[model samples]
Target: MKKIIFVDSTQIGLFTFQAYILELCNLNVGFGIYIETFDIPLVLFEKDASDVVRLSIDESLVQFIANKSISSRIERQQYFNQLLEFVKSSEELAAKIVFKEKEMEYLADSKYLVQMRNIYINSGNQA
Candidate 1:
């Protein structure tokens, strides 16, 4: 299992961080649920020789703010304040994403079944 170390961030940055985590899951990378708080530079992920992946929450927040063009300092401060309320660690977030992905897959499969049933019914009408 690959160990992923994620820097913590706010709710505003959660979605973007979740995307990266989900991608890592798809790649079959494994990470633990340990949460550690500290000051670190902005980065997404770094892989070392020991197969440890480090993710920086500050980097994710910066990217999200830049992408949204949040120029106002007040809005930025609000995000920072809300960070205290964002509780889930990286592993938990990844789990949620995986669960949601599975749910969507199931829905898609059901849709295929419905389409097949419709096709069968239409063929019977034609016959």
Candidate 2:
């Protein structure tokens, strides 16, 4: 298990013990949940390490999260504002080029049924 940190424009989401890079790829590939290497002063994951995958979130996902987040108007605005600042401060794009290329190569091979299966299995989960 690899410890990894994922920082976006506003907040940082930490994923502990990343087992496989392919699983991260599959996560984005299947769910459009973009997770990639961070371009920052302190490198979160080693360049050659495959256990940890960086998280790269974008604008569309922002809108999606905003809608999904059960926050008040002020809170949402604060979150969105922070995202804007991050976008302005950072110039490097999220680490998605490789996965994006592979997705293009195997466009039709998406396992949509697999996503449904995971969803069904987790739907009954109660916390």
Candidate 3:
């Protein structure tokens, strides 16, 4: 079975939260995690397992988040907490989740916002 976490990149601390989730998935060997960007779908992280967890983020969402004029650290933290809860919920939903191969392939080939390349590059360096 496979589970997916849809992330709104406009939220703050997204990279941090994603890193945290990836680490959690790493420690828990039962699940394998992969990251899918709006354009290119990359196996940013993976593990051997019978189940998969996909972190899906859109490039446009990242750009929107970056362009936002007003945001606070506290709000970002709260959003992160919500995401954590969503992940927990997804665990229970994993069994019921269904995905088609064609849909997955389309996601892999989709286009993403090119303006946020620097952010991704920076995050990659930090990782």
Model 2 poorest ten-residue lDDT run: 14-23
lDDT of 1 by residue, 33-75 (tens): 2222322222223333454443333434344334553234454
Query: TM-score, each model?
Result: 0.30, 0.29, 0.30
User: How would you encode candidate 2's per-residue C-alpha lDDT over 73-112 as one tens digit per residue?
Assistant: 4554454444334433331222352233221211112343
- In model 3, where is the ten-residue run with the lowest total lDDT? 99-108
Q: Which regions of candidate 2 are displaced past 4 Å?
A: 1-60, 92-127
Whole-model lDDT values for every prediction: 0.35, 0.30, 0.34
Which is superior by lDDT, 2 or 3?
A: 3
lDDT of 3 by residue, 90-110 (tens): 333332343222112112232
| C-alpha RMSD for every candidate | 19.1, 12.5, 12.9
Candidate 1 Cα outliers beyond 4 Å, as residue runs: 1-47, 56-64, 83-88, 91-127
The C-alpha stretches of model 3 lying farther than 4 A from their native spots are 1-55, 99-127
